[model samples]
Target: MSHVSSICLRNSAFSLLVSVFILMLTACGDLRESKVDGYGLPVVQIEMNSETLGLLLGQVTSKRPVAAEVKMQGDVKMKCEVSFAGQSSLNDYRKSLNLRACKNHPSEQTRFRLAAQNRDKTTNRAILAYEMFARTGMTVPTTELVSAYVNHDFLGVYLLTEPISSEYFHRRGIRVADIYQSKFGNAGFRKEFSSNLSEAFDYEGDGKDNYAALQGVYKTLWDNLSDEEFERRIEMQIDVDNFMSYMATAVYTAHWDGFDNNYFMALDKTKRKLIVAPWDLDRVWEKAFEFNPADFLSRNQLLFRMMTISSFRKVFASKLDLLLENFPVEVQLSNLEMKKAHSQSALAMDKVNGPDLEASFDGFEEQIKVWNEKIRTFRNTIAE
Candidate 1:
């Protein structure tokens, strides 16, 4: 109870409070330094040894991957395998990259794709297109614009996207019996266009022969059937609503490469029918404003055949109308503006594919206006 004892107790409490304050300040400092951009996009930092880097760069034609380490948003370093992604993109100075977390890593998703956006001037086409698809209730991979670095070298802004795989469907709680991806060349449903099924679609299953019955049914659906019979049979093979949504979105976005190529089909076991999803939307929004969906459909025999069915045509028109109503031109233009503001700093710093950011945005705005007008005109004809 002495005065000195009281003073000692007070001093101890003050010191404890000071220690707590210092700890709080240190925690805040760590958060402030984390790898996030002004727009809340994660900055991915990849580090590889000089020898491994040389191996990846030298073998541009090879799909082999090399070991590397990745750190995202100040998280713990994780072991990953890195490989050069894309076919023609390898020829570009700013090459795309694919990353897969090692088994020991603590992440749920193992694979990720970082698109170089070399061909896109604005560097926002794929991200924006994915957003549009998501809004329309279409199954689309998660996409974001990220600033990327490899071995302390800046690779500028890249589109970080989810690759289609079993892991992707598993995350969404969707079960599938088989998955197939359509590559370039004759990817349509015309039997004559493709020498065999494998030529058009690459079966992503362990054994292609396992799905022989399903593949055979798909190929022969067009042969020896009345229009009514064909509709009944085709409905068993593909989810009509899902396919219509995909086609509508493709037409809406002017995804020129998507109709016959750059698409995926998975056998949805729960629905007992195949479901379609789009991939590689970098070529979207590049078509002229006067784009014709009919002309686009003519290239794909399956789509052209479906258009012959009155019910299918009605459903597709309805889907397209819904998309236009839900995602208006004003909202789209606003999104573009927000994205441009968010990515201006990163785009400005892109040295390899130095994009004219402002010019690109202006061009995108003009194209969007024309594209919307074209689709709206088509919608009116459907109404007529």
Candidate 2:
């Protein structure tokens, strides 16, 4: 009887130890999983009713928003409206999303964009663009690399960015009389494109007729006035210094889509001048490092008119020289490395577009070198 009792006691002790060991392993695993990586990029989880999600998924091309709930760790869970965003990315398997916090929400930020990065294999192009722009003292959207989940499924890495809105300007203490976003590719300030001006730009103000001012000042005046008068009118309507900086940044970054489209024009309430801001920078840095600065002037009438003015041309050259001198190549490379490390796991898990996405870092250094050389050559040519 004593031996049997001893055997039972040992078995019971062994069982209890095994259970405790399993529990400890689970706790450690959980801790490891919870550890934030990549400079503490937050996780944003969105939940929505199945029916609404289905409706959203059904319309690939529609911009109509659907109701949903958004929750970011350490932030208030709020009701939000979700919609498909981006022109070319709409058909992508991993579609970009636009989220707007419903009115009366406690959150300070009302609108934001989640870039799918479907075309950006490096996932850092937009981020690099914004960083470069910010270095030049340009107002750009703040961005973060985040792991996004919807309906309890991991959707992969997303670039969480602030949308250009009233809130965006308000945060920076900027007062704008009007805001217009270029919606179509024909948003150039040319008399030929003026007919489609309404289709090209979406005005955020009360009166659509306000677009006539933009046309009259930037297009009609250029055609009807002498060079001196046109320059005077242009300087009054547009902040020439700001515009020059914007052009320099756009050219240096190879932002092919930004000059006439994928940009915002805000009329400053104080200065009463139009300020250009860049958006959708994903298309940059992909082309070969061989482009003439002159090529850009021909594409937009506003650019052509500005470049024709000798004084404005000098300003633009100065801005370009300043940009090239202060280009943060090493810092940008380090940023790319950090983002790659942080997003590696998510990218691997991105079954939709990950497999097709090439490893962009392999040629990144060489690309940067070539770009720098080309830009320097162009600058020297322009100097002569």
The best candidate in terms of TM-score: 1
Error (Å) of candidate 1 at residue 373 is: 0.8
Clash numbers, per candidate: 0, 0
Residue-by-residue lDDT tens digits, candidate 2, 51-130: 56545644546678889877775555778898878877754545788898654446477888888777677677888778
The TM-scores, one per candidate, come to 0.85, 0.83
RMSD each, Å? 14.6, 12.5
Where is model 1 more than 4 Å wrong at Cα? 1-40, 103-107, 193-195, 208-214, 353-355
Q: Over the stretch 3-39, how does candidate 1's per-residue lDDT look in tens digits?
A: 4334434553222212222333323222223343423
What is the TM-score (0 to 1) of candidate 2? Answer: 0.83
Pairs in clash, predicted candidate 2: none
- Superposed model 2: Cα runs more than 4 Å off: 1-40, 103-107, 207-209, 289-292, 356-358
Q: Which pairs of residues collide in candidate 1?
A: none
lDDT of 2 at 190: 59
